[model samples]
Target chain A: MQTLEMGVAEITMRLISVIETDEIFQNVMVRGEVSNFKFSGPHAYFSLKEGEYLLNCVMFNATYRHPSGIKDGTVVKASGAIKVYPKRGTYQLYTESILEGKDYGELYKRFEELKIKLKSEGIFDKPKKEIPRFPKKIAVVSSKTSAAFHDVVKTIKKRYPLAGILLFHTSVQGKEASKEIVNALDAADRSSADVILLVRGGGSIEDLWNFNEEIVVKKVYAMKTPVITGVGHEVDTTLVDYVADRRSPTPTGAAEYATPDLIELKRNIDISFSRITNEMDQKIDESFDLVERSKKRLDFLSPKRQISIEKERTNESFSKMIKIVVEMIKEKRSSLLRNFEAISHSKIVRTTELVPERLDSKMEMMKRTVSNDISKKYLSLEKMEMSLNVHDPLEPVRRGYAMVFKDERLVKSVHELKKSDEIKLKLSDGKILSEVVEIEENGK
Target chain B: MENKKVEEMCFEESYNELEETLNAMEKTDVTLEESIKLFKRGVELYKRCKFLIDSASLSVKEVLENLEKEMEIGEDDMGR
Candidate 1:
């Protein structure tokens, strides 16, 4: 190393040139706890420190105009340039501006104040609207470059492809982000979306401050369509989230809440289908039961079945009468044969030789007596058959007339039955079991 | 009650009506003639409901379908 190469002026100029040439030190932000805080007229001086390291900071009168004073131990985020003092040969942060960070307690106080104001105005206390059970359209408001927007869109498509999605790109952070967000909400409100999703990924309170703006909260509160928000992470709560109809832990969760699961929908439709089918089966079963009951009643009182039974009964009687008539005719014919044989035997030759005319007259007289007796018997049998047929039980009933039976006995006349007697009236198709309350007989 | 023609009902409406009709038919004790009438109406409702369910499907219009395809392509490119 060479000694005595340059003067103090030259060395100071070179060091200052180095400090100005550096990009980060030229304009930088140093966040640390404030100490040695002093505010004189028109000028404020402080030292920012973290643990053992410290940086000397200063804010000139031009940039130091605020009613709130900076005190010791304040955690402040200061932005300024690093400068080398020519006399002291020490570097310091030139005056610019400073704001409080999370540790400073001021930002937290502002958050609480806004929360109180909005709560008092009833903006956060409005009744939530009903989210559509099956949303046909969903509007998503977020930055196009942000993962939050993609998360929601992908989730919605994967879960419910039938829903039409409309994306409104907006700046999610920075000074203008709140206005952009409000405009997006307005557009989404006027559109035909069944639901609107306001979402952004996880970030610090400063990064998410736009969502906490009063304008955005009011817009969310006044939306016609229901709004669901998943701003920031689960632990981070924004005013917009409070005003939304539904809040979720993440962007994808917001999408999930907006539409129904495809499988669940299928199950519901399946349930409806099965319910209808079961009801139809029950109805058909009832109908069949009714038909069967009627059929049984009809079968019990069928006149045709009754008539067949009566015909069989009459046939049995008719056959017996015919057998008796046949037997009588046989007896009469045999007796006539016997008498002819006796007469023929006695006058076989004498009648042929002497008086064929007298023998023939005797035979003719015997034949007429036998034929007259047979005719009389046949006429009586026919009269009995005619009477039986006239009294056939089913004849009257077949002609739309009913037969009344009391205690298993046919009631031939009204006089056979008394008042209050339980009578069974058999009709052509069915039977009526009734009690005869009053009876009017023909005049005697 | 005014009678709404069965053919005019939507799928959800028709399905609900079919269930009601079937229940009424099973619970009431009317004449055979009246039962037959109920049965006829129930059948009509059942047919309408079945037709609607059978024809139900997921439909995405052409513009939206293109949007989906484009999204798929965009996702694929990002994957690569």
Candidate 2:
């Protein structure tokens, strides 16, 4: 009431503002082909085009991702807001859902209607629980007579030869195709397959209708192990492609992507071997050079052979020097003994001569003092000896101080020596040979 | 002026970031120092790319086992 006084223009402006910014749209579906898609971590930005009309959309990362991300040519049945961009004066969609292919909304609605109906009847929800990822046993849900089966089998063999492929033969096209395909899908689901492939090669739009059937789609959608749809050529579209967890361009493509290629593995191993070898070559070369360099630094000049030679030379010279020194020491020892003996004998002789000389000097001094008494005594004895010389011939022998003997006779002086007899003479220097023929005796 | 290629191995973002950096520097009007810095970044990417290529190899094997109870594979020995 207080603001009643305000102008109608201001009130109208307020109403416009409320209409522009405050209104929120509820769950409503829009269908279009995607363009200019941009993904930002947790968000996505894109636009959908329908002839002359274009709508901008934003998908938060969570809803945009469903088994896979959104891409161009994806026909989506999105449910979100028609919000205005104040800056661009345009309206844009804040998305909450996603569906695939053209006429996706209607198809999805039908799909969901049938899905709910079948699930309630336990036809779609209670088919089979699980398929194996690494399948030792596998059952296929395609026409046994179809090339699609052959292609799939061949591809599986090429990719993984050990896997077994069992056929759950079914019609792929025609009026009865949908029922048979659904039955086959159910059977394949119930078989030993770890993963089931609802595969059909590219065909006419009408030819692929079996996959588009709501029954087959439901069966595929509710699979436990994981259902892959390889239903057509690159351009072929089918309901199975949307409902299945994965879709490939062709049956072979599905098989190709389904498992890893052993060929690729072999190529990888070869390349890795080459890479490792190249690296090892480089490193090993470097290491070899390093070892050689270290060895050079340690004992560059003196090799083992040279060192051994030097050691041998030193040992030989040492032995030779020892031998020479030993001989010289023996000679010196003998010479020392001889010099010692000569010195001792000379000392003894000198001591004996010194004593005799001392005694002789004392005796000469005594004789000088008693010389007159000794002369008087010698004169008296000589007079008596001359008187007695006539009395005894022995006196003559005493005077001459000689005794002679010839044969058996004794002569005094030279008379007794006058005989021809063999005589032996002895001298201090040497003995001389002598023969005597006559002898004379001076005393006779 | 500087030649270096940047690449990312972990994620698309890493590669996208490298592409963005390259695009920015290749805009013809950058300073010499800025170009050099970008070149250094390119060198880093080059090293990482080479390291990955030289060190990583493709997977060699894939094994799949079927889970359905009805089918039996007695003769196909899979332990190998």
Best by lDDT: 1
DockQ-derived CAPRI band for the predicted complex in model 1: incorrect
User: Which candidate wins on DockQ?
Assistant: 1
Candidate 2 CAPRI level: incorrect
Candidate 2 chain A: 10-residue stretch with minimal lDDT: A294-303
Q: lDDT tens digits, residues A355-404, model 2?
A: 87888887787787568568777776787786676667456445554333
TM-score, predicted candidate 2 vs. hidden true structure: 0.32
TM-scores of the candidates are 0.42, 0.32
Q: Tell me the interface RMSD of model 2, in angstroms.
A: 20.7
Q: List the candidate 2 regions with Cα displacement exceeding 4 Å.
A: A1-109, A112-139, A150-166, A173-195, A201-226, A233-239, A242-245, A259-273, A276-287, A290-444, B1-80
For each candidate in the order shown, give its overall lDDT on alpha carbons: 0.79, 0.64
Question: In model 1, how well does chain A match by TM-score?
Answer: 0.47
Residue A122 error for model 1, in Å?
1.3
Off by over 4 Å in 1: A1-104, A301-444, B1-80
